[model samples]
Target: MNRDAAPWREDFRGGSREAEDRLFRAMAQAISPRPAARPDAAPVGTDRADRRLFHAKTAVGITDAALMVDRALPAGLVVGHFRPGAILPAAIRFSNASAIPQADGVPDMRGLAMRLAIPAGGPHDFVLANFPTALARNAEQFLALAMAAAGDWETRLARLASRIGLWESRRILAHLKASLKLCPSLAHEHFWSASPYLWGSRPVRFELRPVAGEPPPPILPAPGDNALRIEFASRIARRSVTYRLALQHYCDERRTPIEDAAVDWRPRAARPIEIATLVIPRQDISGREGRWALEQIDRLRFNPWNAPEDFRPLGSLNRLRRFFYAAGDQ
Candidate 1:
């Protein structure tokens, strides 16, 4: 990792230290979510209503005979079931981040949720990500913002400004400006977990980026409500998609805080060390196998907290997620 001074290190105190553990749990429970229909149920987010989801229970594993390079990770950071060379069965779900479902052409945060069953038949490892590698707000801040969206957009922004400050409001607006922009295709877009996590015991973050030198996808029809999903599924039907799963360690507290969910580490610290790959093969969702897969995806929960002990999610955002995620269990 780069030894150069990271100017953002001073802000690295937001992750675990942001709140007392119990307090975060209390805050999550205070929301008073309805009892989940299932043991592992949880909400996708504060933003609910008029939402649309396009899902596929595709398999995931490391690339076939691909090179495995380690970044000198400590044993604690090797994450038991997710070591550099491990591979397992996995499923994925894709959706748009909006309280009200909008057209795929509409600008909105895009999401990718994946669930990988452990080798020993333990709890599935779930990793949720956004197209942008960074988040605009932290735990409490984001919850407040999403809640406000239930009302009018103007009201949401104004209320958020009053709660978090005008400067933050502007910063968030700018961040979303880029984050919500339409992507060429879901298969072509890169995804990030955004929040940091414990790589075993060490602090680090992970992301899945498209591998280079692949054939460029063909252009599709004009913008429509479910355009992204349609195009993604169509492309997959023709060929498989692959992404590199890489991890970046925390060099220093200031450079890479473990508690803050809003801070973007590795911006100046160092590049991610490629550890594994994710390959999603083509499938016809209209067929019997596809229908069975979709049913499975809908029945289970997809939360970052679903991982094993070594891969536990870190930071305040994760803490806040404790209750809401379980609430979605069904």
Candidate 2:
């Protein structure tokens, strides 16, 4: 295999890869740490899945707009209750995904998880990721990668594996390629819901594509690691920025596979349909306000499974994720 190229890079050009559910589950059972409480006692906790620490995180208002589903879709185990022209209010939080909470230049992933803030009901949390696609193929691979990052002997072993030709090393390489992105400003980066989620009954994916503004010039000096955060703060303080909330429906098992999270939708032919518009208004997040924002969100659970009955997250990776971050009373 070419050292610079991945053998499975073109794998998604075919159809969906069949998942080994039992294999993933068994591995999870063996490696999954025993929670402080029993699985039934408390399914989920305030503890994050992997990205355990963050900064420059804040909530922004989502306009009360209609989410027009382009096609006829169902609810219940899907984008539940969401249809063409259904009015809703939403909010988003921007954060750095670092378990050890390192500096900005340290190669890591950033995230933007949104949630519907309804007046009389619960919220549907949405994790819009910075990566175009996930670094692992299935639940088993995903778990291995998380364990490696979770810190401890596992992390050491994972790093050692990367130096050798091991399966875990492949995942590390994928993580490096997918997560180490050029992010000078939030307005320039396109965020994705890398894993597949139920769009009504059909399995589909979501993306937050930047609709305006060009990337900061490459010749600009590196203003330190928190440059993206500083730019984001400055952007919001000056004016609102927009990102097209779009969806990609399943076309085939290969091109739009439900199980594999490692491949992006190849050939950017049809731009995804714009379902809703995310307008992030300018605001201040310094001093007490920033601290308060962090405190409030840090206490709340922000898993992708924090959605409604209609929008059930699918695939093995999500299943394992749900296992790690369920929201039972603690």
> Of the candidates shown, which would achieve the greatest lDDT relative to the real structure?
1
Give the residue spans of candidate 2 off by over 4 A. 1-87, 150-168, 171-175, 214-226, 267-271, 327-330
Q: Scored by CA lDDT, what does every candidate get?
A: 0.59, 0.57
lDDT of 2 at 278: 69
Q: CA RMSD for every model?
A: 5.9, 8.1
Per-prediction TM-score to the true structure, in the order listed: 0.77, 0.72
TM-score of 1: 0.77
> Residue 273, candidate 1: how far off, in angstroms?
0.9
lDDT of 2 by residue, 1-330 (tens): 223311222222124333443343454455455432222233223353332323333322222222333343333222444654555565556666654555555556777777665434766778876887876676756655655655686466555465343875766575766687555566766889887777545566889887766335344424675565566666666666767777776666667677778778653632466666666655664446655654555555566776655576877677666545532211
